[model samples]
Target: MRLIPLLALWLCLTCQSALAAPVRVLNIIVGEWPPFVAEQSKQHGPVAHLIRDLFKEAGYEVKFHFAPWGRVYSLAANSQLYDATAVWMYKPEREQDFLFSEAVLQEQFVFFSLKARKLQAERLEQIIGMRLGGDIAYSYGPELDKMVADGKVTQQKVTDVKQNFGKLLRDRIDLYPQELRVGLAELQSQLDPASAALITHSQTPFLRNDSFVMFPRKMPDSAKLRDQFNQQLQQAIASGRYQRYFERLARGEY
Candidate 1:
């Protein structure tokens, strides 16, 4: 009967709709590293925007959860609450617990000092006796860490970048090492023009390194997700979209 045919068509459509797969969502954890990743910035900063777009191309949506750096790293590594964490510099020891994506961002760290001091150091050893302001939770690099451990350099530890810069301005610390862009962004946001102008970084880089997104090794699909992300990232780079994000960042669009 005509009624039967119409019901059959309706059932077929219903089955097809029900069978369609839902878009997957990736819950990613991140910390405050502005101009790269920050909770308050548009699309959570440039690197985060790039990551979202790459995942969108791969048919996944990203939900970012921001926390303190130490908590962010610890939660992502030990718990299933997050699918991954972003923008971590490579450390061989971290390989045991997480799988790293292809290099996401290249960071150049330099020493910021009072313009009056005009501190310039080609090597960590060059600034050995000077008091270095540092984030207690963050690692500068292996060489700098070793120097601090061996008591080759005097380091004054603080809880955050803002504090280090504050100490720098107060003449409490001789030098503070931070990523070039991140340091500039922090100065612009945290200090008035006069105060910010007093701080300048060295021309020579203290450290140049690449950062990456990391997935917990315990996750069953971590490798697969990382591989998919890498593929999308490479394609974006080839299509010139990846570079465009950074261009926008330079223009303060993010």
Candidate 2:
């Protein structure tokens, strides 16, 4: 009778321990946007580190899956494999497919051009007839998008940033607009010192937009996860921890 009681107690303890284990894992999909989210950078870049820390505070472990930008958006929207996608700028069309979290980062978009060309544009209209290079499926905000749609500016679309940069270098495209830090990181990583120096960006920013983490609408717990993430992010911001991540990013720590 004593042995039977002890065995029952042991089973009960084991069950309790199993139930208490922390097994919440978030499968997040992302793309290669250096100095923010990159497979090769430290802690997978600052944004990744920020996201991981925030989720950690919420009692979740984040597992990042990197793919092409197009595929990242498509998979996160249509497939059940990924819980969310990170660091996307807001667009009305995107809201249809995913629930967006509070703004993660604010990005400044500017036009990159060859210094030799002496290109100076205070506004999009100033460069009305120039050939612009752009990444496929990217939104350059409503103003520029309308300009392109109205044929005020000619845009040549490519698969990735490298291709657009290459086109700009080769004079195939006169300008390429991209996030400031991201464009600089790409130049540093892709071009030689002299070659990189030849490229420069306009002083005026074309768009200043906030980017967010998007949870797929199809996921049952998407709203809950987004709410939890937003709460953690707000707390971090209030405590000044959120700004520290960007400080580290500025110092090239990430």
Candidate 3:
């Protein structure tokens, strides 16, 4: 009968709806690192935009929480407050607690200084005894860490970029190490043109580090999710899907 056919179709539709898989939403923590990750920008800046796109491509939902760098790392690493962190520099210590995705980006670590200071240096040892500005929580790689730990070099701690730039300009610190692109973005946006013009980074890089999305080990789904993301990331990189994000970056659209 016509009524039987209608009921059959209704049952089929209900079964399909009931059998559909639920969307997976991954919570991620992010810190302020401009031209890459920032709270104010649409898509949370280009790097983050790419990250969001990558996960979307993998059929996962993403929720981003922006906080101070130190707090973000603490929450992501300790309390399992998030399933992952947007990006972080890889270190052996992190490996024990995190399943890092394939390299998402590379950061050229360099020193920023007042142009008048003439603080150009190709080597960390070359600038020993001078006060270097650094964030307490950041890693400048193992070699620089050892140098600081052994007291071979001195570092003055500042909480954020504004303070770093202020101290460098006042001679409170001679040089500050920051990712080149991050420093450039901060200089242009946070400081007046004249002030920004006075600051320049070292001609030589102190280190180059690959950044990655860090999945906390405690998450029950961490390994599986990481594997899924890894596969998609590899494909994105290989097929040039990821490069489109940078193209948007070049156009200031991101």
Candidate 4:
């Protein structure tokens, strides 16, 4: 009868509508960098929250997988394990493999040494022959990287920031480079109170850099996803949501 045909048409339309629903899910690899993206922080920290909010506004679902920086970077760059990885500084080699988003956060690289060492360096040249502690695969901007590469500065690699702090306290290294606040936080949490108190960071920052999220080139529709995320991120900044969120984060208001 006419009702049978109409019902069949209606069911077909409903199925088509369901199939057409736009729900794009992205798996983003992230490393544990506190106050930026951490498993224990509220909403997994501000940068993580910003990424989630921006994509969600554009009708996308974001799932974050936390891992070591090396593992996260490798998986995101070489495999289909992740659609994106976050909080990396802009690097030319990385640009070849992934598309970088606008900077979501800014931080300064500072030198940390024991209070008794009397260590001070106004320039990279001044630090020549000094042992610098840093992560093996990480980039500390062009100047520092060049210093390490050219043998102007002796570099020691550690698995974590806390290890660097430990090495510095034990006088195994001359100086450790780290973000000021992040280094202080790690010191307070990972070191005994006396050792943390004996450590001090330089007043002069070695490098000021911005952090960004990266979308892998291998992901299907990566360009489209980047465009969508960039659009939403701009809207967020224009509407003052971005600034407000960052301010709240700075105040530890979560």
User: Model-by-model lDDT, in order?
Assistant: 0.90, 0.92, 0.86, 0.86
Total backbone collisions, model 3: 0
Order of models, best TM-score first: 1, 3, 2, 4
- Which segments of model 2 are wrong by more than 4 Å? 1-12
**lDDT for model 4, on a 0 to 1 scale?**
0.86
Report, for all candidates in order, the number of backbone clashes. Answer: 0, 0, 0, 0
The 10-residue segment with the lowest total lDDT in model 2: 118-127
* lDDT of candidate 4 over 1-93, digit per residue (tens): 899999999999999998897886889999878767888888998889999999999898999999887788889988887888998999898
Output the better candidate (3/4) by TM-score: 3
Better of 1 and 3 by lDDT: 1
**Model 3 clash pairs?**
none
- Candidate 3 all-Cα RMSD: 1.4
> Per-residue CA lDDT of candidate 3, range 177-232, in tens?
89998898899889999999998888789999999999999888889888888988
Q: Best candidate, lDDT-wise? A: 2
Error of 3 at 234 (Å): 0.7
What TM-score does model 2 achieve against the real structure? Answer: 0.94
